[model samples]
Target: MGVFRIGFFNIFIYLCCAFLYSVPNVCGHNNMCFDCIDLEGCKAPKHFLKYMSAVDRDKVVLRLPTDKPDPMMDRCLNTGYTIKATLNGTVCSGSSDGLCHAIGEATTNFTITYSHCGDCYIACDCYSQENGNARKEGPIILTMCLAAFYTLIQ
Candidate 1:
């Protein structure tokens, strides 16, 4: 009985790993290369967050990388950040205007200065089916799978 149980667990682990590998993720890189919008320097390329304060209001500091500008990029959903820098374990504090905000799903879309990105902008709301809310799916899937596996083991 014990040997059969051990074999079952081993087979289960192998299947789980295979399933994970079957899913491809664009998160292994540091940037998201969208046709309209662009971002770079995300410490967690896979878990690029769209909104954080919603998840944690009073979260004045967000752990994210800065933005990389493109010449053809024409709109701003959330723009005009007073300051922008890589949060490489560094903390930042400041006031944000009506336009400046930490809102999104995967990676943070923040403005740097008034020159390129100004205040009072909108339309950062478009999401592709392939890339939209899928940013939040990986962790959720893994968590659920692990939970189920734990229960099975028990």
Candidate 2:
């Protein structure tokens, strides 16, 4: 019983450390990334591009990612358009114009006139590729550590 309890506690600590190490520092300017757009009553990447095409038809060209979007990609659809981040142990959600606010988590049923990510021509996906990898290697390291730890306990 004692050995089992010790092993469980060790696993819990390992999980906490792994999680903390995985969080990115989130420094620099709060980057502008597409959270989605409202078009024809739909909030999606395709809609965002369509709306932009009409708004800046002569000035800019828009396209989807060449490769499939990474599952780890942060931007997605939600009600009222939201942004989320992590704190000590709590997950925080807020609007694009504000900090991690207390507006609560987003839902599929939310609505918004626009997400306010249209200030740049470079697109959010490009920005993600440039800076989103801050914690990319952290997951790989955590996995390796867990595998080694499992072997030790076995």
Candidate 3:
């Protein structure tokens, strides 16, 4: 009876661990949300915006039309560029060109990077124009404690 109870608990714990680890990656890559901070208020002449919300592993890419004339080109050109990310309206990371990662308590991290640029005028706008890609690998399992916790709870 004791061995059977132990086995059942172990199974339960294992399932719970799996569930928690895999939940963050489920918010599909192609999902788009407009009016994001990186897109809505960005005044750059030409900028590529990409964000990975803590709830999702895939980067959300925002593409804006270049046909419209922008008055902010002067500021954009002068400043060169800027990149920003936020969660719940709070700034998480900001940089001119580099990788920034913000780890939250929600079991995920938000990372943003800006790269490759030339003259910054609206007409001369240059950026690293590339399609964003997201790849998912199986959940990380690095602990016997986690496995035991997973199995015991089951």
Clashing pairs in 2: 79-110
Ten contiguous residues with the weakest lDDT in model 2: 86-95
Q: Using TM-score, rank the candidates from best to worst.
A: 3, 2, 1
lDDT per residue for candidate 1 within 1-154, as digits (tens), equals 9999999999999999987864423222221212122211111222222332243233223323464432211121222221121221211111111222222222444433221111111222223322645878878999999999999999
Q: What is the C-alpha lDDT of each candidate?
A: 0.32, 0.34, 0.30
TM-score per candidate: 0.19, 0.24, 0.25
- Candidate 3 residue lDDT tens string, 1-154: 9999999999999999998866544532111122122222223323333223343222222323433322322222112322222122111222232222221222112331111111111112212211112111123344666898999999
Candidate with the greatest lDDT versus the true structure: 2
As for candidate 1, its clashing pairs are 48-106, 48-107, 49-105, 49-106, 49-107, 50-104, 50-105, 50-106, 51-104
Q: Is candidate 2 or candidate 3 better by TM-score?
A: 3
Candidate 1 vs. truth: CA RMSD? Answer: 25.6
Ranking by lDDT: 2, 1, 3
lDDT (0-100) at residue 34 of candidate 2?
Answer: 32
Model 2, 90-137: lDDT tens digits are 121222232221111223432311323222213323344444566687
Q: Candidate 3: deviation at residue 69, Å?
A: 28
What's the distance in Å from true for residue 138, model 1? 49
